[model samples]
Target: MSKEVAAQFDELAALYEDMASWPFRHDIETPSVIAALGDLHGLDVLDFGCGSGLYSRLLKRSGARSVVGYDLADGMLGYARRRAEKEGLDIEFVSELQPRFAGRFDVVLSVYVLPYATSVRELGEMCGALAGLLRPGGRLVALPIHPDYQPDPDYYQAYGFRLIPDDDHDRPPRSDGARIRLELCHGRYQASVHAWYWSRATLEAALREAGMTDLVWRDPSTASDPAAAAPLLRAYLDRPHAALILARKA
Candidate 1:
C-alpha cells in the first residue's frame, strides 16, 4: 500500500504544480500552514514530506538560512529541483534518508505525511525519527487529520461518529457537527485509508511519549472562520488537509 501511494505521487509529479497552485482548489494545505508559520528568518529548516517543494520555496522566501526537502516521490523531487534551479534558490532535495541529518535542523515541518502510516506503531517510529532529527529546543511543526473528523468504521459507522459544535480553542472539542468527505487517494491499491484521527489529548500523549513537550495545536484558519460550515470544516480537516502542531525538543 505504501509503495502504491508513492507510485501514485510519482506519477502525479507532472501535474503537481497545477494541483498545488491551482486557483480554486488544491490537495495539500499549503496556505493554511504558511500562514500559521508566519516568518522563518535565519531558521535552518528540514521539510519532511515536502511534496513539490511549495513550502520549501516559501521557507526560503521567508528568509530561512537553509532549507532541505525530503520526500518519497521522485516526480515531486524533480519539480522541486527544477523550481529551485530556476529561482536560483539553494534548497537541497534529499530523496533518501541520511544518518548525517540527525540532530541537524532547527525546525522540521511535516506537512501531510501522517495519514499514510497504517498503524500507531508506524506513526510513532516516523515521529521518533523526526524528533531525533531536531536539535534540542528546536521546533517541529506537523499537520495531521483532526480526530473528530476521523472515526473507526468498525465502531462508529452506525452513528457516523459524534458531531458537536465548538468555538473555543481548548474548551471546545473539535466541531463534530460537520460532515466532511475524505477522499483517500490510493484507494485502488489499498482499502480506502481515511484518517488516523487523534484528539488534542491523544496527540499530547503521543508527543510526550516521544520525549516532546510544549505541544501547541491550532485550528485550520478555515475552521476558525465563523462563516465556514461544519461540513466545510470537516472537508478542510480531512481532505489533503493538515492540523498545525508545533512542539519543541526537550
Candidate 2:
C-alpha cells in the first residue's frame, strides 16, 4: 500500500467499523461475497484486505475451520484484534502475509479492495499475491468497484450517500484513473473517503497473468440470495454498482 493510501485508511480506521455496516455493504456486497464463496465448512479461509476483521468474524461464524485476516493498516488491525478478543473468536489478523501462509488456504475473499491498485502493474502484483496464497483448486472471490460505474444522482439520494468525482472530468486520462469522493451519513456519524477506479479489461488481464482460470463476471443480483437481499438486488438491477469476480487457481 502507498503511504498516502495507508494513511487514509489509518485515519478512517476508527470510523470503518460503522462504515462497514453501510447498507450497500451489509445489504449488497457482503451477501454477494458470501454467495460467491459458498460452503465454507472446514475450509481454510483468508480475508484479504480485511478491515477491522468484519468478514473474518463472519467466515468463522459460518464454519470456516480457520480464518485469517490480512491488511496493511495498523489501526484497522488493532481494531480487528480487539474485536476478535472481545468476541472470543479465534482469528489470526496479520499486517503482512507470512511465508507459511502460501498455498495454505482453501478460499480467499476480497471485498472492495481491488480498486486501491493505482496502476495496472500494482493491480497485477496484488492478483499475483492472491494466487500465491491459494492452493491449487483454491477459489478467489472478489467484489470490486465496477469499471463502468458512474454515480447516479437518484441512486445516491435514495441510498443516503453521495459520490462526487474529484473534478468535472468524465473520465481520467491517465492510466491510474481518477479518484472519487465517497461521503456517507448514517445517523449522527458522517464520513468521507477517496476511492480509485480501474478498467475492467485491466482487472481481467491481471487475473489471467496470476494463473487464475475460469473467470466469470457475475451479475450483482445473482451474487446474492434474492429473498434476503431484495433491496440490494433491486438497487443493483436499477443501476450497476459493483462487479463480482470468481476465479480458480489451476
Candidate 3:
C-alpha cells in the first residue's frame, strides 16, 4: 500500500469506527465476512488492515484463540488499540507485519485491503505477504472491489455509500491500477478514500503466484433475520461493490 493511501485512511480513524454500526456494514458486509471465516473457534487469526479493530474484536468474540490486528496506518492501529481496550478485549493491535509473523497464523482476514494496491506488482506482493503470514494450509479471506463493480457513483448511494472512478472526466476505469473513489456516509457521518482496481484474472494470478490455491468467490449476504429484513439492501447485495475471495496457502 502507498503511504498516501495509508495517510488517507488514517484521517478516517474515528469515522471508520462509527461505520461498524452503519446499516450497510452491519446488515451486509460483516455477515458475509464472518460466514466466509467459517467457524473461527479456537483458531489463531490475523485481521489484516483491520481499521479500528472491528473484525479483530469480532474474530476474538467468535472464539478465535487469539486475534492480532495488523495495519500500515498508525492512526487506525492507535484507534483500534483504544477501542479494544475500552471494550476490554485482549486482542493485539500492531502497526507492522514483520518477518517474525510469517507462517504464524491459522487464518488471515482482510476487509477492503487489496484495493489499496496501486499496481499489479504491489498486488502480488500483498498476496505473497498475506500468504507468508499463514502456516502450511492456512487460509486467506479478503475483500476487494468486485471486478464487475458498478461504475455509477450513485448506484450505491442509497446504501450509505457511493463509488466513482478517479478519472479526470468521470469515465469508468477499464484497466488494473486505475484509481477509484469510495465515499461512505450515514446520518451525519461521511468519509472518502481512493482505491485501485484489479480484475478477477489479475487477482487470481496474484494469489496463485503467491503460493495460494483453492480460490472461491462469495457474494455479499445478510446477517439479518428475514422477518426483520430491510428491503433496500437487496440491490446492493445483488451487485455488491466488493466481494470475498477465500483461498489457502498451497
Q: Which stretches of candidate 3 lie over 4 Å from their true place?
A: 168-171, 223-229
Please give the TM-score that candidate 3 achieves against the real structure: 0.94
Local accuracy by lDDT, each model: 0.64, 0.78, 0.87
Off by over 4 Å in 2: 167-176, 222-233
Q: Residues 41-127, candidate 2: write the lDDT tens digits.
A: 999999998887888999999999999999887888888999999999999999878697999999999887887776677788889
Model 3 agreement with the true structure over 1-250: per-residue lDDT tens digits: 7667788888678887787777778888888888899998988999999988888999999999999999888888888999899999999988777877889999999889999998898999999899999999999999999888778888889877888788655445856778898888667877888888898999999999999999999888787654456667777776788989999998
Best by TM-score: 3
Q: For model 1, what is the error of residue 189's alpha carbon versus the real structure, in angstroms, after optimal superposition? A: 18
The numbered model that scores best in lDDT is 3
Instruction: For residues 167-231, write the lDDT of model 1, one tens digit per residue.
Output: 23333334322222333232122122233344556566667777788888876654244345355
RMSD of each: 8.4, 3.0, 1.9
- Assess every candidate by TM-score: 0.71, 0.87, 0.94
